[model samples]
Target: MNDISAQAATLQWNDQGLVPAIAQDWQTGEVLMLAWMNREALELTVREGRAIYWSRSRGALWRKGEESGNVQHLKELRIDCDADTVLMKVEQVGDIACHTGRRSCFYQRLENGEWQVTDPVLKDPQTLYGKS
Candidate 1:
């Protein structure tokens, strides 16, 4: 087991006591999404082997699979040299991870000097988030 105290001491959380976290597919190495994590979220993620992110809008820690059952199982956790950002390697469950019902959050791209949609939705958002 990694030294918890050492790991905690190394992190550089912002003034709000939050750090940026990037989630990626462990096998494919595809970046899935970006989120913020406070100390509680980070600790919960490590302890539970699941992806947990701090919800800025909700002002709470969100466990990925709690509602949708679209889970992200922790594979590895890496921190940059500065420890201001973290990369979480995860094994994602379900066809989509994005709120837009896409497989990834980075579904847009600049192509041919134009902003273009790169990834089509794998599932319907309405069915997931409900029409609002």
Candidate 2:
């Protein structure tokens, strides 16, 4: 048996010990982004009342908006029927959720079977991240 945190040991984790986490705008019901969460990340998020996720790319726990000022203040956390996915209602600070300086990561739409960018960049990435 895999050792899991007592706080989220009941959650149905995937083979990688991760569960999909979806962040949504609390007021508007807009899904900001989908990230992954491990036991520690989930526990931290719940404990801190903020969005903390496991960064597969970085192979570490990443607090949302740790680099940028756009933090997702957790309002509510809910699990799916299968307990495989976590839905978070959050107050998205800075009004930007997407890394590309958009409001949400889901700014693309499938129009005529082609992916089209539907959202505009509110702030330039260079300015937000202090990089190109």
Candidate 3:
């Protein structure tokens, strides 16, 4: 097997043939998002040097910044000890990783009781996605 395929084979995928992948800022060490990846997605990401995930909702491959111009350039990829999770350090282009136009998908923080919005939206979602 090739290097990319060989790497994918080592991962412990769930029954759905998916593994949880976390994207983090390469320089800042800030976690940007969490997504799922199938074997093909993992191989494509390694070969292309970018972040690509399997979209459960869309039922297809979702390339980061494919529509929003916020591509994540991969810097490094690491697997957990259990080989079940993937951590990708990447240079996030356009400074946005969340579809909500925030820098990260983890925008909520629990305060005394309720969840609060912590990060401000860097760009308007409507503009990013061209929504009406």
Candidate 4:
């Protein structure tokens, strides 16, 4: 834990005291999702070996899969050269990473100048989070 804190101290957090964390598939190297991590959230993620993000909307620490069961187990964590961003190589449980039930958050592509969703939802959000 101390080691993680020492490493995290080297990161260049933004004015909001958060860094952008990019989660990637450990085996395939596909990017999953982008989230924010405050100091505590980052530390907890390292300690817990799972994805823990700071929710800008709810203003709290969001434990990935707490509601949806799409938790990302941390395989490796890296800091960029500029120390402004974090990369997490994770094993995504349930094979879903997006709240929209897609495999990745970046499942949209722009074709002919029009944004289109290029991936299918592996599971329904309502099925995971319950109707509400």
Q: On residues 1-132, what C-alpha lDDT tens digit does candidate 1 reach at each position? A: 333555866799899999999999999999999999998889888888999999999999999866667899999999998989989999999968888889999988998899899899876777776554
By lDDT, the better pick of 2 and 3 is: 3
Model 1 spans with C-alpha error above 4 angstroms: 2-5, 130-132
Could you tell which candidate, 1 or 4, scores higher by lDDT?
A: 4
Query: For candidate 3, lDDT tens digit of each residue in 12-109?
Result: 99999999999999899999999999999998898899999999999999999999989998899999999999999999988899999999999999
Q: For residues 8-58, what per-residue lDDT tens digits would candidate 4 score against the true structure?
A: 888999999999999999999999999999999999999999999999999
TM-score, one value per model:
0.91, 0.93, 0.96, 0.95
Residue 32, candidate 1: Cα error in Å is: 0.3
State, as a TM-score between 0 and 1, how close model 3 is to the true structure. Answer: 0.96
Clashes of each: 0, 0, 0, 0
Poorest stretch of ten by lDDT in candidate 1: 1-10
Candidates in descending TM-score order: 3, 4, 2, 1
Clashes of 1: 0
lDDT of 2 at 102: 92
| Candidate 2 clashing pairs, residues 3+ apart or interchain | none
Per-residue error at 123 for model 2, in Å?
1.1
